[model samples]
Target: MAGQPTYMLGNRNKSSRTRDAQSINILAGKAVAKAVRTTLGPKGMDKMLVDSLGDIVITNDGATILREMDIEHPAAKMVVEVAKTQDDEVGDGTTTAAVLTGELLAKAEELIEKGVHPTIIASGYRMAAEKATEILKTITIDISRDDRKTMGKLVKTSLTGKGAGEYKDFFADLVIDAVLSVAEETEDGIQVDVGDVTIEKREGGSVLDTELVPGLIVDKERVRPNMPKKVENAKIMLASFGIEFHKIEKSAEIKITSPDQMQMFVDQEERMVKEMVDKIIASGANVVFCQKAIDDLAQYYLEKAGIYACRRIKKSDLQKLAKATGATLFQDVTDIRPEDLGSAELVEERDISGAKMTFLTGCKEEKTASLILHGSTTHIVDSLKSALNDALCVIGVALEDQKIVAGGGSPEIELALRLSEYAATLKGREQLAVSKFAEALEIIPQTLAENAGLDPIDKIIELRSQHEKGNKNAGLDVYTGKIVNMLENNVLEPLRIKTQALNAATEATVMILRIDDVVAAGSRKGAMPPGMPQPDMEM
Candidate 1:
């Protein structure tokens, strides 16, 4: 009994050690990758994801699809994280990252079955990722922030293969203008905050009616109907304080012996509200954006003063207002001064569709821009928003980095070709991993061809021939099933998108490959605990 080895784990715990664990994890990672594989390229299809509550999201965006899925497998979730990272870093190429990750795992599975250690495969992947990144730098073409035509091409490339592709030229110009409006030239480089470009959507109009506003649009209206709907030469006061009488912070009880005391208290409250409103008026701010509530008494005073005010504004919108109008946000009404006000040429409340919204245009600094997207239905608007977001992000990345690359799967095919050649110079099994990495990249073009109803095998063969002939920019033209120079076709994207996707995919694959054990504690749903005896119901 003493020599007997004790089980280190509790009976409730379940574990899969070594090869079994690796197989399970690899399978899970591959499965997640496969889920979004078909959603790649210009001819890709969309996925309609419906949650338990019956709400639906339809999109071909890889990150959206993965985010909407209720994935439970731990390894699969890691793969999903790859897509998320790609989205956050570049806002596009999520599907390529996911599909490449899956292919890497699928190829690694072959090596694993052939007795190659997981560690060897992982080391190979690391080396291959580094080499691929180096290769990307060589192929990237220099871009300038002032080159609106190329930037628009990059935006259009991103918007393609989705719902907004039909209006890509329109959306592309809108996105480029929106991004550049918020862009500031810093000592480091041209800095762009995509957040400064607000996208507002309204249903009932055609998509062609979408227009960019040179200022900010707040989805709120003036607090009082009698208030002036429009203010010219708007001096805006952004306030975080409520224009209401202060409420008791803690529980309190006051005994009133007569109606005179109650009347006096009411008068005091009115005076307090009036004083707060007076502070706003003294600041010479004709338009007010408050982060908190406005009392009815205060509203009456503000309306009487001919001030257009909106109450209970979102903190984010208030911040944008400060940037757009060159104003300071005041935490206390007493602290407000004329110098703290932000100026706008015009502030007007307009009825968009059936809802009232405030539009602040011709701001003093013009540091923010807004796109009012129009569509006939909720779904179309949502899809358009997604597409435009990707476009804006890529354009921003291109401006900041000042580097662009040909799209339409051109980069992937070229990277695969060069990586294969580089793999040949590497020693030992790492070459296999590097070569496999190259092969994995071809999946992008293959999937593109497949989605477009072309023969993937033949297309890849033709693409390889073109690359072999030194056509580095050659990519699949999905519509015509021809291998064309993407650069000549004006299919372009930011270099950041390709580099980010490669890094995310390779890192995720390497992390998954290094796992050789999985110890799952607690019984899974509908599954029995380990070492538990089965119930005999046949008796």
Candidate 2:
């Protein structure tokens, strides 16, 4: 017993393992939050995220910023997911979700410090979130989808902080028209699909040149120079397969015995191409948009037929064209019929930015729409594209839900005020956690004020007072540095943005709080989370 040496299992001990993983997770969440917090409000700053490869991104969009940075911390990536979820689900409010989650974690960190368990804090925060959403439903106003003026305001609000702020009026009008063009009235409610709206960016024009096309556009030209540049009352044939020989599926060698046989083989291939073109012509399709290439011989025949054809069209473009023109996508040229052709008043190939692009216009009944975005610099165009996309998604959601809420941080203030009242009704430490959740909600308005260079505390006090008086619409008017009614001022957002942001932020915060350890894959060295100490390093 005295001579035996002790053995170690995996060279691990409780002291060697990372302690305070939950604390580290919360800090990482907060760090990610602070990184994007300044980009929250209309006056928020843009983040210049440079990746490991030295690629640069200058953006105020939260989801874009988080995505661009090379994040390594597992908990930090969870924070990033908050942004992605908010962006994917609501199209706006990624910054709000990230900031709220960070603030929630910060507040919960304090509750943990006070000896309250993480689960208790999570449940309390959950309760506060539910209460906040209920208050939101009460305060939101019904927005009639047919009311263009009000709907335009909803879009303008979305575009306010983005680089497109200067062109809000023009862009808002364009966005609403695009949304309404694609929206359909169903038996249950109005349904909108954002994919129905396509955005095309081109240089050499100002933002003012941006216009809405009622149909679709593809950045492709007529396959041959001899093809007609324009076709009137076009009967369109959309094909997913190439028009040449219909595709053989496999390659083979055709050996010729003599010059005469080679000539015959060539003639046979030409005749086959001619027959395929004849079939399309018999179907009465004067225009063709092929998702695949058109053979040179087939293009020649198509040109001879005076057909306007665009080859190598994207699958998405083909589908939208079908929707816009009532076109049927053909896999077989043999089954062509007049009934399969889609009608567009005009199919024209136009030179845009030195490239040939085709436009299918005059389909007034079709639900597909296109937005042509123009700007002098790629940066401005890229930023405008993002803003316009957000604007469209927000309006679409608003129209679908038939409900809207005041933006400019008014809703958060109202939710905070209501949540605080709800928190007061609870007993014990859970009440404190709920109250902390309410305060976390206030971070939105505070950030709005801070980003505007206004006094955050004064803004919060004024907003809280206004909310107390049943003026639920009262919110920080960052542009004016005053407390005003967001609805009266025409600053509005979709109700889902606020509700979804809170839902995502709370879920993420709770998830981070619930984690007690993080074991990385192939972790060879004893793990020590950032800000936690290693015994050897301390020595």
Candidate 3:
């Protein structure tokens, strides 16, 4: 019934569009996987990324590497999205997600060439992914939420090869405290909003100088030098009102019958600002944080009232202060009450990197916290922050889910073993696809071994043998290049990390495999300047 595929019916269109989309996409996926494969385990190497502006970033993080890269291929970009989704959902295992997705597509492409339909391969992959998830549950080890030591180990595992090995213990403590500080318990489970942990970077000092503040820290300096430098037992007032005069909407010159009339009008504007300042003073607020600008007259009055004030504070900082200090923000300054005011044990201005910053310390609320990140250079600090984010996210998810699995490539190998056994129970072409899925998952351990400078073939064989011998937690030890108990070594990751990785990797692979045709329109004329001719284009 077919004279050829519809994508090939039109001679001109057929030449422009890629007919073998499966092969093209699989190659693109494999290309992207190779870019990040070397950055896998404890001994993994770092990628040095440079932008057009000559800004350089060196790291082994999969999310950062993909984000910084200038990827042109559409299929490769989709693979990059898998790492992004994994980073967003679980904050770790981004490399595993991307590599697994590429391997899945690579295996499926082989099946397609062997006369298996893409839909069949996709369904097999979907079923295998589900089976993999079920197998994950069998290997996960329950971790007590009360175990800080083990939790520290979990965060350290995330930070091991992230170029923070020296400060793993130090950073782990801060990350755990920061996450737990903002973690909220809901009816469904533990809810974590990492945004509650404010990270302010300053280029000075060293990494060891970084510490956690019990409250929010804003980069804003005091509005006036005459304002108090430090206030003990500070009463904080959060005012959303723009502590300034409202300019007349229309530009008009008022006819003054006399100088007294003009003076009265001028004095009235001053009175309005004075009234707002008096309201704040009456509320017993020793420190004022404003989201909007403060009129010069208001500043003069506030300084005279012996109150410290900072204007133009960011809205995020204002909300964080509200949570940390138990303060209520007021729309109108006149309606402020004592209960509406927040308090900090001491509100002081400190000189950080030669710039003044306000620190609200010893707040009553544990719902918000801040980390002052310090480093001798911006590059180190930036990479350190990314590493910390991964750790914080993983710990948050682990505590929320209350479960973890052995890291160091153990879980993937274990899943591969279980999936292969399950695949043997299937029949037909789907069985071949399922078996491919099992083989594809072994890439994690293999890459880990290769990155750690060990023989991947030998390592994978050793891992398979250990699992066959009923060592469920057996995994590749990158440091020793042997199969050991990952759980006993405390190489653990959050359960959602693996589950989310599987879900994302499978979704991306299926999406890529089902693409039978790719049609690209010629570049727009307006996209280039006039008189510039386009070169020979190909899909």
Candidate 4:
């Protein structure tokens, strides 16, 4: 507590009297929603979001777009969380979830001002969400295990409008196969534990040669060069606990009766040490993980024979190593490596537990070795460990999830659609929240359209009108916009105009109702800031 602030919030106000300001929060949440929903389908266009730093990100991925945005309103942050939650749950469909949530919030705001309580709006929304999920499930197609064609379609469908390249089918199939190999049937859902499937790229290594190892392998050398350079047909012993070198009785001390007796004691010690070494060699274990000290003579003998001896190996690593190597591991070192050396880096000898491990392999021979570290700080090790974990997680995701779509604007459009549907079901003014949410979804497509030198508002209107007449698709249907499609008489996917119109109108209404205050914290006494003031803020 010494370094902590004695009185935090010293200059901060505990309360504000802005409730009477009669301003509606334009619902940054709603805005985000509107921006995302404009590009809901294949017809969807991309968004170009440029931040204050002039950094530009062009994407339609809802999660990425919101993440990149410079949002200031606290309410909008809640919308962002909705997207985050979706990402956590499905690892995909985040944009769709977020756009829906934003539209819901926006519609709720409108109905709230129309004398409807937030509770009713929320209840209805909960019901609708459940219904929507049910609807999706009904429409969801069942894919056959043998239907490689459909699988290809699914992958291709997932990759549509994604990064372009050659050999996409090959890559997709490879990813799919890897994922399918680990797929496990469970009662709740299909479970695939991909934590161990690592996808790594070396500077000069081919992707095809990537393989899995039973245990960890590193590229390191023995702790000491003086230790055995190599051991032939070696018996390996692994242990997680330490041991004692000298034995003692219940109440024994250093009190020798005679010089002869003392000499005998010394000889006994030497015999015990020699017996231990002989047992290891006889057992055919060339590698031993020792938790205790080794006698100088035994160490010298082992070193001369080119046996691998490691000390202070972590218990976790030992267990994994043992499992991989199939070597006999115990608290005591009497057992040796069995007929099978097991697929392990090496049978290590160590005292400590909870240390991360990497096995170093020989370039020519796949011989396992250990690098006994001497000195290092905690931070350096921890950082390295974290980096490894991140790398591993990314690789695992790639191996397991098998796909990643463009984020940012793509998701927002979906959110808008879901929110617009909710708005339609609302009974009263609280539906305004859903409307606001829908409006928020439009920002991206509109921005994109505007940037492309087209009339975004007019396009929105056209899309909305077409969508209202039971058109299932409208907004960003990209494929239908092609010149070849026109010649081929390819009919465009119908747009859901009613929902789009509702989203746009509600956003406009909310934005107008919300523009009550124009406080510029940086300006005072009629003085302007360095840069040109916001056009909207100018009186």
Quantify all predictions' global Cα lDDT against the true fold: 0.88, 0.85, 0.85, 0.45
Tens digits of per-residue lDDT for model 3, 1-539: 67855433222222212335667678889989989999888888999999999999999999899999988778899999999999999899999898998889888878877888888888888999999998898887777667898899998999999867779988988998889888898899888888788888899998999989877788888899978899999999998878988788999888989989999999999998888888888989999999998999999999999999999888888988898889999888767998888988888899988778998888878677888888888888888888888988998899988999888888888889888889899986788889999999999999988888889999999999998999888988888887899988878889999999899999999998878666544334323222122223332
437: Cα error in model 2, Å: 0.8
RMSD of 1: 3.6
Q: Where in model 3 is the C-alpha error above 4 Å?
A: 1-18, 248-268, 331-339, 520-539
Writing each residue's lDDT as its tens digit, candidate 2 over 85-194 gives 98888899999999999999999999888889999999998898888888889988898777999998988888888899888988878899899989999998999989
Clashing residue pairs, candidate 3? none
> In what order do the candidates fall by lDDT, top score first?
1, 3, 2, 4
In candidate 1, what are the lDDT values of residues 1-539, reduced to their tens digit? 88987667665555666787778788888889889988888889999999999999999999999999988888898999999999998899898889989999999999899988888888888898898889899889999988888887887788888999999988877898899899999999999999999999899889999999888899998899899988999999999999899999999998988999999989999999998988888878899999999998898899999999999999999888988899999999778989989999999999988889999999998778999999999999999999999998998899999998888788888889888999899889988888888998888899999899999999999999998999999999998989999999999988998889888988988998888766555565534344222322111
Steric clash count of candidate 4: 85
Per-residue error for 503 in candidate 2, Å, reads 0.8
Looking at model 2, residue 179 earns an lDDT score of 95
Clash numbers, per candidate: 0, 0, 0, 85
The candidate 4 region of ten consecutive residues with least summed lDDT is 485-494
**Model 3 poorest ten-residue lDDT run:** 9-18
Give the TM-scores of the predictions, in the order they appear.
0.94, 0.90, 0.89, 0.48
Per the 3 Å backbone cut-off, how many clashing residue pairs does candidate 1 have? Answer: 0
- The alpha-carbon lDDT assigned to residue 232 of candidate 1 equals 93
Off by over 4 Å in 4: 1-13, 16-77, 112-115, 159-167, 187-189, 204-539
